[model samples]
Target: MITDSENMKQTNANIAEYTVSEISGALKRTVEDRFGYVRVRAELSGVKRVSSGHCYFALKDESSVLDGVMWRGNVSRLSFVPEDGLEVVCSGKLTTYAARSKYQMVVDAMEPAGAGALMALLEERKQKLASEGLFDPSRKVPIPFLPRKIGVVTSPTGAVIRDILHRLSDRFPSNVMVWPVLVQGEGAAEQVSQAIAGFNAMENGRPDLLIVARGGGSIEDLWSFNEEVVVRAVAASQIPLISAVGHETDTTLIDYAADLRAPTPTAAAEKAVPVKVDLEFSLTDLGRRLSVQKTKMLEDRKQAIVALARALPKPKDILGMNSQKLDDLSERLPMALLNSTRQKSILLGRLSGSLSSGKLQQAARFNRERLLSASSRLRPISARLLTEKKDRILVAARMLASLSYQNVLNRGFAMVKNDSGNIVKTHEGLKIGDKGEIVFASGSVAFETSSGMNEATANMPKRTSEKPRPKKPNKVNSKVDTNQGSLF
Candidate 1:
């Protein structure tokens, strides 16, 4: 509301109701109240960034523009990615950047104009790619330990390229082929995949190793690396592959499908090549050991040959051994013959002694038979003669006794009898009897009379201390005590 009523200097006092500071303060308050940490829809423009990591940008379209700042903390949340030509809607607080003396909005979030719908589309694409078996582990290639040639798939101008090159050169100086491709914008995945396929098709023995790498960025900025097409290409690679993308914490399907994964481009290069200096040192050590072993073996063989030459025998020595054997046989021959003759003589003597023993045995057998015959004859003759002699002697003795009995009786011609009429055969059986009978060699007689008592009984000798009186002293007269076979 400008009026040309007074000169610019004269109208100043009339318009002194509001100061520039007060208006600015009022506007600041109004903007804060209206748009405090809110979400707004606008196109991106005038995007400028300061060294402090604070982004200054304009949210504009054909109709209007709003100034904005994204501090470091909030700047990380952007999705559609703020660029000069890109259109996005921001979510932030409308406030003043006091240090710059500027009115702006501090953006906390941003996205493409229709990100809500685009998310659905992206999810569908993800599913479609996933169903095609592009993420299968079976298709992944193996990474070679020592690669002579390496193929890099990344932006040609990014820090990733420099980092990987430096690492490869440090690890092993060798030829590396760069397969540069767009790593970020639309169709970035297709271009990257094509580049991989192209490098493979070139085949040139297919480069020993393939490195897919990129510098660190937000997930959206690095989405091309996570695409299914890129993953499938990596898996299908004939050569071994290494994936290096973003920070150590960032992961993608390409990382899973590749033969190896590294946290950074430099690490990926380091994994692909072996250190040259270390390998050379190892080779030198092995060669020295091999040479030493060969020399020792040659020395051992030479010593063996010398010992064999020293041990070899001469022809004259062999002839001397044969001559010694011949003389030994000659000295033993006469003693062997003498031993044979003595053995034969001993055998003949043993045969003669055996014949003499047989004749002596025959003579001993004849003598034994004669002795048995003599014993048989003496046994029968002696038994018969003894029986005849005993019988004759008994008969002669009986006749003689008959003739001598009368002679004896006549010499004693008297008989004695006792009181009981029994004969007094001997003086030992004599007793006084009333009757007596006497027999001589030719006659017998009986008498009754008294017999005399023995004088010893009359004396009583000590019988019971009394005289055993004879019974009236029966006196019987008897002939002399002479009997046929009795003697008094």
Candidate 2:
């Protein structure tokens, strides 16, 4: 029984005899040592290479990623410095690091993630500068071709300074003043901005032109020139400016804001200076053309003077023309006077002949003869004819007096009329009881017809009922006949 109990105890102890480290070591070996290592590619991010020959960073992409490790040797061979935002294709093997107890990539090699990230960075910078109106063509200044003084703003230690100096010396050999500035750092943008502003503010006649420049670098390293403050300072500068930043493939905000943008620092310096040979040739051509123009102008003036002298009239010619006009008038005067005298003499002779013609002579003789006869016989003939006419007129007057109505009435002959007022000459026209008018030499009376004129002539006895009538004169003639006819 004792032997069996000891054996049981030994078996139990053996079954429970394992430590935590031992178990964990077995599990690690089983999980990690069996799988095949993988080589993957990703973009680099959060890159940090330490001095211990190890790099700790993330290899991530849009969908999935892992941590990465690069030994210092591999990192040193990179053509470009790795940064957080740089896209890089990494080749590495998947492995578990025992010390850190984490699965990570041990990278053997890296290359740029290709052109996509570079283009993306360029577009982002473009939009940033464009929003600030730095790319506006209107904001560009006019650079002086042959600047009197050129102001250079750049890193003192950079190759850009060397390039600019050499180009300027070669092209124009101009006087230049360099304003040193930090091209990369915390305050690098501000330093570049201040340098530009300082050159503009220089009291002793600011530089005729300015050149803001830098050498090629990575996007981050060249970012100072892309800053808004630097861009605005360049735009606000009074002097014309040239921007020489980075290589031709790289652009910054200063490029857009400057008056001129050169492909390189050397190009910017070339733009600032004029070629001495070209200027000298131009001056010579201008001088020759000016001399020809001066000669032509002198000839024009001489011709004008000669023309003016030819157009002027001489005094003697003017006097001779007037004298000829006077002589013509004098030669015609006597002929005009003689013609007028001849016309007057002819008119007088014609008038005298008309006065002595036969008709006029006959009229004169008749007037004289009639005048003498009238003077001798006019009084006696007139007196005789007047006496005879007066005697005849007296006889006719007496006959008219005897034939008038009053004279007939005085001789007792009265007129009577009928009822229609017609003269009643015979008694047959009378009507009994009709009223009638009887006219006397001096008066008239109306009577009712109770008696006739014939009765009046017949001397009828008065009727007792009739009105009384005056007695008519007895027609007894004694010696003289008083009734007479008219002498017309």
Candidate 3:
């Protein structure tokens, strides 16, 4: 806020100023109002042309000079070219150039300094175009014998159109395409050139020939037809063009560039088509002449045939041509077949040799040897695997043998059992007259337990009233309990 206030104060110290365009526009308005449409005569200087079709130059006298610019629209209307040293008259409003900050005259009208200037310019342009071969007669297109459609470049509202239509209607009466364009004044050359180009650009029933026509006029009225743009456009046209711009006395540059030149619009139409009655008569005559020529041609052909027959070979020789050809083919047939069969037989022999039994046997032997070699490599591994498995089996068998209870029996010991074949580890399970089995090393024996092995057979101990004490197992004692399954 403070900086803005400071700027405001600084701006207030100086008075308000106008932009460059604002001042220039004010000056322009003042000058145009004061010196409107003034005419000046001065020598042209520093004349330069730009691609935009505008020419910029200086209007100068001995003491001072003023800049001037003539746009394409105004430049095209001039009767003569503006040169650097040539004095000329110009008429337009004065205006200030904003960009350059200077004043200049926009020239809308220009003319030569003397009466001969126009002719000189016209001649100069003609020479230039001619030097570039624009007027070469060899480059001219031949007018078509019969054009299905004709295009005309002219004012649509003028009597020129009516006259052309009437003339063509009187003749062959073809389809006509009319291109409307301005023929004089500002932008006339542009419109005329564009109209010609438009006709050239059309397709699908495009014109066979074009006619650039206008009513009779003075050189200034017909000046558009002579512009470089219009002439070039006519020269570059794809369709054949006919120049009928003015009366017979008036000529234009387009007349030299067009394919055909006609003195008037009606004459151009007559040249573009033929009279219907005359064509019919000529066609009838042509038909009669053609029939006569055809008959004469047939007669001449008959005489030619007779003469050719006289020069031909004899009939016998002519009839034998095919037979001679057949004889030649017959002579070649057997050798050709024989050669083909020989080649096939050679191929068959070579194939048979390749498929012989010896070769098959060799292949089989090679496979068998490969199998043997593979088996030979695997033999040691298979044997080692078998040997190791057998050794494990033997070791397991030894372990199993050592774990067997029959080994104890093989030590000359027996396992005593009761009558149910239960092992009796103690003799208490057995009593006198009780039968039992004794397991030996290889067999078992059934035996009756008569008494203890070391005790009397008939002696027995009676029940006592006192508690008995445990005694040594080696001797039979009165307190021995014989109901136990252990033998100590």
RMSD of each: 45.1, 43.7, 47.6
lDDT of 3 by residue, 261-336 (tens): 9999999999999899998999999999999999999999999998996676644454345445545655665576
**In lDDT terms, how accurate is model 2?**
0.71
Per-candidate Cα lDDT values, in order, are 0.70, 0.71, 0.79
Clashes per candidate (backbone, < 3 Å): 22, 1, 4
Name the lDDT value of residue 40 in candidate 3.
85
TM-score of candidate 2 on Cα atoms, chains taken together: 0.44
The estimated TM-scores of all candidates read: 0.40, 0.44, 0.49
Q: Which residue window of length 10 is worst by lDDT in model 2?
A: 479-488
- Give Cα distance to truth, residue 208, candidate 2, Å: 1.8
**Once model 3 is optimally superposed onto the true structure by TM-score, how far is the C-alpha of residue 130 displaced, in angstroms?**
1.1
Our tally of clashes for model 3 stands at 4
Candidate 1 Cα lDDT to native: 0.70
Q: Which consecutive 10 residues in model 3 have the weakest lDDT in total?
A: 475-484
Sort by TM-score, best first: what order? Answer: 3, 2, 1
Residue 440 C-alpha lDDT in model 1: 68
**Could you say which candidate leads in TM-score?**
3
Candidate 1 per-residue lDDT, tens place, 271-326, comes to 88889999999999999999999999999999999899557554345444544554
